[model samples]
Target: MCYSSNGQFLTQIPTWLIVVAGWFVVHHLSQKRDQRKEARERVDQLVTAILSIEERAVRFHQSDSYQGDVARSLLFDIQRIIAKLKRHPFGSFVISPTLLKELRRAVTLKNFDASKFTRQEANSAILSNIADAVDDIEDQLEQEYERIYLSTEWFVVPSQQKNCR
Candidate 1:
C-alpha cells in the first residue's frame, strides 16, 4: 500500500515482482531468438547441400571428359552434408526415405571408376531422375521452412505466463 500527499490510498506492486516478470520475458525471448537463428542456419546448410548435389549431377551428365578430382570432392562434400544432417536436429527434413534413395542412386551415377560411360545417352536417364529428385527435395525443404516461419507464435509459453502471474 502507498499514500499520496493528499492522503489518498494507492495500490503498489513490489518492485521485485516487476523485475522477476521482466526477467522471465527477457529470458524466454532470448531462448526463442536463439532457436530461430539455429533454424535459419540449418536451412541455409540444407540449401547449400542441395545446390552442390544438383551442380555435380548436372556436370556429371554433361561432361564427356570426366573430372575425377572434382567429382570426388563433390562426393566428399555430399557425404559430409549427409552425415551432418544425420546428427542435425532437422531429422524430419533429412530423413525422407525416398529422397535418400534417389540421392543414393545419384551417388551411384557419380561413381567415377565404374561410370566411364562413353555415350552421353547412357547417363541421360540418371541425370533426369537425379534432377527431378533434387528439385523435389529443394521444394520440400523450402515448403517446410515456409511452414515454420508462418506457424511461429509470439505468445509466451504457459511456464513463462506462470512466472508473470
Candidate 2:
C-alpha cells in the first residue's frame, strides 16, 4: 500500500512539473512575440516619418512659394528622425551605416535658399540631387527592412531547426 501511494505521488509530481514547464515555455514565447510586434510597429512609424519627409520635400520643391521656414522645418524633422533611430534599441542592428550616411547627405540643404531661385530654377540640379538622395535613402530603408523583418533566416533559431544534427 505504501509503495502504491509513493508511486502515485511520484507520478503526480512529474505531471505537475511538466504542466508548469509547459506554461513557462508558452509564457516566454508570448513575451518574445509581443516584443517583435512592438519592434515592427516602431519600425513602421519610422518608415512613415521618412515617407512624410520625402513627400514634403518634393511638394516644397515644386511649389512656387518657397518658405525657408517650411524647408527648415522639414530638415529638422529628418534630423529628429535620424536621432531617434540612432537611439533606438534595435537601431544599430537594423539601420545600416549607409542609410545614416544618405540621410545626412539629404539634410545638407540647411543652407538651401529656394526663395532666391526663379521658377525655372525649381527644376535645377539641386532639386534633382535631393531627389536622388531621397531615392537612395528609400532603397536602403527597404533593404534593411527586408533583412531585419521579412527574412525567415533572421528569425530562425539553430536549435529549433529540423535539420540540426
Q: Which model scores highest in TM-score?
A: 2
What does each candidate score in C-alpha RMSD?
Answer: 6.4, 5.5
Q: What is the C-alpha lDDT profile of model 2 across 62-134, one tens digit per residue?
A: 6677667877788788778778776543453455566666654654443347646333255665566666766
lDDT (tens digit, per residue) of candidate 1 on 1-165: 445554342223456678999999898878767766787788788878878777776776566776777667767766776676665445534346677567756755544553554424545767777778777777766765444433455564423332332
Q: Please report, in order, the local distance difference test score of every candidate based on alpha carbons.
A: 0.63, 0.63
Backbone clashes, candidate 1 = 0
- In model 2, the clashing pairs are none
Q: Model 2, residue 129: what's the lDDT?
A: 64
| Candidate 2 regions with alpha-carbon error over 4 angstroms | 1-4, 107-111, 114-165
Pull out the clashing pairs in model 1: none
